[model samples]
Structures are given as structure tokens and as C-alpha cells.
Target: MKRKLSILLALVMILSLALPMMAGAETVSLAYKNGSLHLRKGPGTNYGSNGYVRDGDYITVLSKGSVWSKIETSAGRIGYIKNLYISGNGANYADGTSYFGGSYTGYVVTKYSGSSVNLRAGASTSTASMGQLRNGTKIKILGENGNWYLIETASGTQGYMSKTYIKSSAGSSSSSATQYATVTGSVVNVRAGAGTQYVVKTALTRGTTVKVLEKTTSNWWKIQWGSYTGYMSANYLRMK
Candidate 1:
């Protein structure tokens, strides 16, 4: 009897430590635009509604099937949510700053400092924005910079934002390479071809951070990421 009791206590201690790590491993966030999302008892809509979830709710995504994701709610409620309604905005990469393989139902201001904040593009000041920001505001970071960031707000406002006001408790992977640039205050045209006069794919916003693949000339650097690519103003990128 004594030996059994001792063994039981030992098992309990091991489980206590392991449980917390496992619980923290598979976490995800709800999208800011998501409202009245149904939580099912299992990883399928056919399973039946376990409860209703709102925006800004933090949940743990345990596993995923084709269209449904099994999530553990904050209240210890386990259920499923459809993938279509969830925004996997930061779900593509595992880089410690992004939430990959999961859904974000709402925007949670991860960081908050003073009442004012400076928004940037691609996570740095090299990116331009419409203007400054305030506190308690939720924004989505499209990309990351060296301590700065590029973020989009709820009302379809896309621009640059500082990292000081945003925080994320989700798991992140290792960081990637550095892509820095300068601001020439010019509307650098992003082209599909690598020349001065190609079909203008899109116009780069002022202070946008771009990854420099190769410097085609003293004035142009081949860059691409997330959809846009082509020749941008060399003066705008800080090539080392």
C-alpha cells in the first residue's frame, strides 16, 4: 500500500509539469470580424453546437480536418469552427510573430503603451502609413520588421504600425532574414517585369519595406514578397 501511494504521487508530479506544456502548445486566436461563431462538440459542423463564440476570444486549436478545426475554448469548452469564417491572416508562417495553422477570429491589441502609436509597413518605419494611431486599438500585422511592423486595422485600414502596442501569446517560430529600406517619399511603382517601363503591377506605398533579391542597377532592385514583386526605387531600399 505504501509503495502504491508513493508511485501515484510521482506520476502526478510528472503529469502536472507535462500538462501545462501540452496545453500551451496548440493555441489560436479568434478574428476581430468574427461574431456569433458556433462551437461544435467535435471537429465537424455535424457534431452539434457546443456553444457560441465571439470575437477576440483566445482558443486552442487542437487538430484540423478538411474544413473544420478542433478548438479548446478559454472556458475549457472543446468544439469545432469552420475554416472559411476564420481568418488565417497570420497563419501561413510559424515565425514566433505569426499564428500559423490556426484561425484568428478577432484582433487583440497585443501591446499597448501611450495613447499614441506610430504605424509602419512590413513591421518597420521604412513602410509608410496613412497616419499615427492611439491606444487600446487592435491592428493586424501583415509583416514584420526589426522591432517595428506593418499592420492593418479593423475598418479596412492598411498601413504601418509600431510593435510596442501589439502583443501575441501564440506560439512562434524562428525569425527570418532582414529586409530594410529607406524612404524617398516617392510612389515607387511595383512592376511585374524587371524594367523601367513594365506593366505597373502596383504602386508601392511610401516607406514600404521590400526584400531585395538582386540589384539590377544602381536605381532598381528586384524584390518580391506576399504577392507584389518587381523593380522598385533603389533609393527606397537600404541594401547592405
Candidate 2:
């Protein structure tokens, strides 16, 4: 009995020492736009897309190649993405930034700061907000007008961001682009506008999937739930 106990303790000690190393694997976040970066079975695009990671999702980098990189998603599914789409050590890469639907011209990297930067329909703050770009989000500069930079997001969201909140960066990537949000509050009230002062249009239960139309600079999401359109507090939302 004593011998058996000693052997078990030795095994436990070995496992305890090995556990940290196993969990310490290098990890990186996928910076590509929504539905664009495919986690493939092989290092190239020809391989089957076994899974996918969107902007702001973190995964483990197993190995890397010149054009492709092997990665394991947080879900433990192994795959590969174009080497350009993954960022490490909180760093951003310029070559991997993707653009869409505009005059095919040269691209420049711009940095955004603050909790969120409003992408507006025009160059002024009074213009309608098309969406909100998260902090560290990179904008591919298409053109510039005065203090505003005409930019495009990975999801093809094109708008102008103020020059005040933007800095010319070496490079950056889309961090946590809004795709969908799951309601976390138990029967949270849905406001008609982006604030509490607005009327309660309806209520959404926990686990309800909300169609994220766009985000306001105030951190409210204009969402569509069951044919009712309104804004909700972004604080109670979770992304899958």
C-alpha cells in the first residue's frame, strides 16, 4: 500500500510540473474581418476550411510558414490561416489588412484610440454614425478630407473617422468587430433610442440573439429583435 501511494504521488508531481508548459503555448488573435479568415486543415487556402476565427478571437499558434500559419482555436480545433491574418504579442501587421469595394488604390494604415471611434457617413460629427470601430482597430485609408480619413473596415464598412482620434500607424488589425450579440440580461429592456431616456420598445430575454445593426459612440448597439428595432446598452451583450 505504501509503495502504491508513493508511485501515485510521483505521477501527480510530474503532471503538475507539465501542466503549466502545456497551457503556456503561444497564442495569437485573429485580426481578419468577419467570415473572411478561414482556419484550414492545411497551411494553404486549398485545404478545407475546418473552422474559422473572426476579428478579436484568440487562438494558439503552433507553427508558422511564409504564407500560412498553423493555429489552434480557443475551442481546441486545429487549422491554418493566411500568415497575414494573425497578430501576436499585441502587435499588428500591415500587409494582412484587407479592403473591399472602392477605387482600387494604395492603402495606408491608421490607428484608432478610445473605447470606440465612430465611423460617420460624412466627415463631420453631426453626420449619422454608420458604425463604431473598436480601439486598436485599423482603417485602410482610401482617401482623406481635411481632418477626416476615409477608411474601410474588413467587413467593408466605409466611412470617415476624425483625424483627432486617429494616428498614422505602422500597421494594425480589426479588433473585435461587431457581428452578433447575445443578450445576457434577464429580460433587459430595449430602448427606442441609444439611452435610458428613450421609451422601452420591448424586452429581450437572456440568450436571445440580437442582430447588431451598428454601434453608437456612446457604446449602445442599435439592434433588431423580433421585428422591433431599437438601441440597447452594449454592456449586457456577449459575442459568440
> Which candidate leads the pack in lDDT?
2
Model 1: CA > 4 A from native: 1-34, 84-240
lDDT of each: 0.53, 0.63
lDDT of 1 by residue, 110-169 (tens): 344555666532344443334566765655554433454435577655443554555542
TM-score of 2: 0.36
lDDT of 2: 0.63
Question: lDDT at 141 for candidate 2?
Answer: 58
Question: Which stretches of candidate 2 lie above 4 Å from their native place?
Answer: 1-25, 31-36, 54-58, 73-76, 90-218, 221-240
Cα distance off (Å), candidate 2, residue 237: 12
Clashes of 1: 27
Write down the TM-score of every candidate: 0.26, 0.36
